[model samples]
Target chain A: MNVEQVRSAVLKLSVHNDAVLSEQGPHCPGSETLDIRHFGGEESIVRPAVTDMHFPEVVFPTSRVGRVAGLEKVRELVVEHHRLIWHSPLQPIFGGNEKHFWKAVELTADFHAEVCGGPKLYSERKGHPHLRERHFPFTIREKDRELWLDLYVQALRNVAFPLEVAEEYWRWVESLSIRMINRRTTFAEPVRVPFNHIAERLA
Target chain B: MNVEQVRSAVLKLSVHNDAVLSEQGPHCPGSETLDIRHFGGEESIVRPAVTDMHFPEVVFPTSRVGRVAGLEKVRELVVEHHRLIWHSPLQPIFGGNEKHFWKAVELTADFHAEVCGGPKLYSERKGHPHLRERHFPFTIREKDRELWLDLYVQALRNVAFPLEVAEEYWRWVESLSIRMINRRTTFAEPVRVPFNHIAERLA
Candidate 1:
């Protein structure tokens, strides 16, 4: 067969499932500066890189919730956490507009579902999560990260998550939260809410 | 100790390598539409999912070049191929400006090295290659894809890539070229150049 024919035939086989354009801003005249207007189109969301359960939260106990509640609980928990953020002072910082905030809630639900050992919803839908890049646009200060962690802790408590499940999930979010800190003032204040504030609710 | 204090201690363990933002365009008033100017900052590049070798090029002979020349050869091969594209009629379509052109060349080299079983430069620097999304801004018709493939074949001839290496690499390019095609008229026309035109140069 003519090599061109062969090459043409080969070209036909390249069927890709998804194609994601680079999130880095385009190189126009005023490209270097972080212009929110130009960056408005694509809200670069990425998957979390760190999945390991850490510390006290790492010592996870077997939970009946995951076996029974599964992804449904994940969605509910994420929605609850988002609702708290939505009403809190940090809402705008965390979620730019109402549409963006709701999108974040959906993405978080996908993340929780995937990371909690359920379906690979996030990766399959969104490709790998570049969490830092996704959060780069926001001025994620130390307090913001802590408040985020607090909301998750509160959400877990409110939902009555199994101790093992709650701690394990917290470990992931807590660590993941620190990386989100792109800005911070002097005096790196610690989290105001107790880490296991949800634990008391269980009792 | 207070649960919050102890939890704070646990929170200390949240370590992450990096977090990337979602690349999907922002949901601004007119964000949904694909505007090349808006997509201008970064020269969008992505990975091809269909990696299978195909057709007469299917029987890939083992290349002594990759074993002997290794990554150095990959760099040369990619650079040479990019140069051909740079000087050719296809230059503007592939690389809009000098800066973007060089960037494309660099990215292409990175991709070549990684797929040739060398260092994972592309993946490390650019995450997964969402080939389709990268090419989304350009109106890639069938002719464009074919011309791209032709350039590769010619480049291989110019560089005198080992028979096995040339064919093997061609299989990849031929397949990859198809994914870059975002537009085409009915009944895709055959390449203007003869198949194995590069092969004729071998004699």
Candidate 2:
């Protein structure tokens, strides 16, 4: 589909989202953005990279509601707690070729550990995914990297994990995000601003 | 959103649909003209609805393909069985209360029985939705009714319902769509149509 069509589909999915758009906006630790919108009729533009981001809410389809509500808190918390660290600037970028440098970070095992509610879901599913080591094959463009982050956000955003419970989780995501990137040796853009110390680039 | 925004959203959603604007247009059953801009995004001020329409192969979302494959043979057919019926000419203008009238009919128990595979799902948990009696309290306004229909199309389109195995089931959905309304006595212009005969306008 062209960019506009993609945006239209995303918006349609967003409009009746009683399942995902709980209480108006979504909060995650270290999510990327894929802002979809229409310039005119039917056609859409997708800004697939996320910066200082927040998931504004829309109505979710009904079927998803039960699934979100039904998730075990421990597993939910496990995912949320890592959000902050994942988005942190202190971490190093992934060093080699990769589709999503951040996703390649060796952090999911740790993220699952924080879930405490249901840690076994991850540990038993697979021991651990080595980060930098596993990402040496795919070509990672800036756009592709951003898209990976966007998808990660999507995976986490739809399942409601509450505000207070989710905030701390976000912090962990931010922290882990810094460690996911290995491009510190080459590119010098998309300035990584610190969480609490996010600087205003404009007057 | 304001009326203009709502209208724009409608225009975008309808016009941007890939299935409606393919090289092979309006071949699917139940397809209707909607001033949709065809591929190549050329601006078109007006285009009429076709009586019958089908979705393009790629228009089906990846998520839907997996779901449609799992539905029982009958449930799968509910997507577009009665194009001949819904395609029939109607006194009411297209996009008029006809679609609204559709939402109303589908809210009935009798209409539910006739459709191939739908009778069980609606009442399985919610019980018989005393549609006419319940609708007495609510008169859906012109705009709300239109939006309501739009919402249904968004929710129901393709929806993983299989092809012919689901055809009879779809007839029932089309049938029940008429029962959703309770406007028994009206002096409104544009003669009202029977719920049962809706299949005629849809093909």
Candidate 3:
């Protein structure tokens, strides 16, 4: 077992209290103490039970505000963000085509609506977001993520979101954006654009 | 840019000569020397130039002995291997249903045929076998990989694969099996099986 698998298990446990975490065989015995504890009270207090293992410090938003500016407001910001990306230098990442751009916009809007404590539009319509798998065809980089976040920042200002609300929402968006980065910036060779041959044929 | 990304880029480059491998922005400037070189005398020799970077030693068989055994013999072994897995404890990993089992069998056979230099049936039909993404829904551990490998080992013997050929084939299978493992043996909590809610509803 690697550090990543250990971390994944710990994170999964931190979220789901009732789930039993185990592997099929005897390996990585050091993770025995990596667990979570819940204290009974008016407010259920939950905390990590292990400190020996090197766990990366994660800054979770303490606020349960859910929708910082409510569902409609979040949707509006998301739509604006997608619109900017549709016309921005990052357009090629979304296929540089109108249909693909709009489809991505719709998907993001639905995803944003669902995540911001609104209707479960994305899950109901698209099962699970599987964002990594969805973006696998594209070689996303740090610049692309920054470009994406910049659009959202502009969208937040355009929508007139409160400073605190915008900051909180930005925190989540920033972290999520980092998760969607699928490629490295210093590769020995350039990753081939998903279907260069097909595009060449069309050209 | 990081060690993992650098390693992935080099490995990808080493395998596919025509593959254009480039990372986005400049991050790891040192990787410029970590490259492959082609020497032409009688046969073009290709290998990694840099040794400082952490790269797993991969033994790629240069001999195009496509099918160690004949294609028909390989197919026979692959069929038996899947049949054994279908009835074994590993069945649950493939969905534990007849339809899913058979579909998996067909896909694996196609994949095996292609890898053994038989035909491009798998790629032509299914595109790139995003094997990791395909198995992402399942929590695959080291033990599962061992079980899968065991089935193949037994099947190879059953088909009377030549000892030298079988050993060479086993080397590749063992390495590929390691790549398929996506999880560890112990977690802080159990992984949420894909479609848990739906399964509960059905039960």
Error of 2 at A185 (Å): 9.4
- Worst window of 10 by summed lDDT in candidate 1 chain A: A50-59
| DockQ scores of the candidates | 0.04, 0.01, 0.02
In order, the B-chain TM-scores come to: 0.61, 0.29, 0.59
Which segments of model 1 are wrong by more than 4 Å? A1-203, B1-65, B189-198
Q: What is the C-alpha lDDT of each candidate?
A: 0.50, 0.31, 0.48
- Write the residue-wise lDDT of candidate 3 on A79-155 in tens digits: 88878887786775665469857776777776666555555666666653434334544545545777787676677
Lowest-lDDT window of 10 residues in candidate 3 chain B? B36-45
Candidate 2 Cα errors over 4 Å, as ranges: A1-117, A124-129, A141-143, A150-157, A182-186, A189-203, B1-203
Please write out the lDDT profile of model 2 over residues A71-186, one tens digit for every residue: 35434433543343344321122223333443533345333432322223343433332222222221222333444444334434544444333333333343333323322111
Instruction: Report how closely model 2 matches the true complex, as a DockQ value.
Output: 0.01
Name the top DockQ candidate.
1
Tell me the interface RMSD of every candidate, in Å: 24.4, 27.6, 27.5
| C-alpha-based local distance difference test score of model 2 | 0.31
Clash count in backbone of candidate 3: 10
What digit string (tens of lDDT, one per residue) describes model 1 on residues A1-203? 53322432343333211221333322211112322222112222221111111111111112333454576887788898888888875665653468867986898787666555456667676655545435544445455677787777777767766565565555456654654454322112324344465566655
State the lDDT of candidate 2 residue by residue for B129-175, as single tens digits: 33322332232222333334433333334343344223333332333
Q: Which DockQ-derived CAPRI band holds candidate 3?
A: incorrect
